[model samples]
Target: MAKHARPGRIDPTWPDLPDGEHPVSELAAATQGSLSPFGDVEFPLDDVPYVHPVTEINR
Candidate 1:
């Protein structure tokens, strides 16, 4: 069994995901500045930064 973080709280210093979970930030970074195909039109995909809730509240 793996340990899970408590609800409504996340550690920005060590953000760990449960099994089979992938970070959205990783996906965003991987496709950063790429184009998304959208039915005869392509849209630019911008890299959106992910800010933790704690950090956001502190700001």
Candidate 2:
């Protein structure tokens, strides 16, 4: 279900970085002091119901 870019077109999902800016270097700088894991680390999942993909598809 993900949107893909055409053969010669840039993906809109990606950030439009300035010239000479490397993606790896930009990522490193963005998470420079991050010590926590990704996602909803602070959210409580005990009350959330797990829905199977097949079940969701049939809904």
Candidate 3:
């Protein structure tokens, strides 16, 4: 049922797994920060500005 089964969808699980000892390797030093989704290259956690809703009823 997954879209990867169809012709061009390459399942990047095994191949994509970073090379080196787990927990020991930081990955950035090995791959040269190629994998954006893995480390600091990833999108920063959004600090969404808080805006309280105005609940005052109009007279």
**lDDT (0-100) at residue 46 of candidate 3?**
75
lDDT of 3 by residue, 25-58 (tens): 4453556534554456435557746688989999
User: 43 in model 2: Cα distance from truth in Å?
Assistant: 26
* TM-score of every model versus the real structure: 0.21, 0.24, 0.20
Cα displacement (Å) at residue 10, model 3: 15
Best by TM-score: 2
Clashing pairs in 2: none
* Candidate 3, residue 32: lDDT: 53
Give the CA lDDT, 0 to 100, for residue 11 in model 1: 55
Lowest summed lDDT window (length 10), candidate 2: 33-42
Worst 10 residues of 3 by lDDT: 21-30
Encode model 2's per-residue lDDT on 1-59: one tens digit a residue: 98885866866677777997765543555355544554435456556667666644564
Report residue 46 deviation for candidate 2 (angstroms).
31
Angstrom error of the Cα, residue 12, model 3: value is: 7.2
Off by over 4 Å in 1: 1-12, 28-59
Structure candidate 1, residue pairs in collision: none
Predicted candidate 1 versus true structure: per-residue lDDT over 1-59, tens digit per residue:
98886866865666588987775544644455544444334335465456666644554
**TM-score: which is higher, 1 or 2?**
2
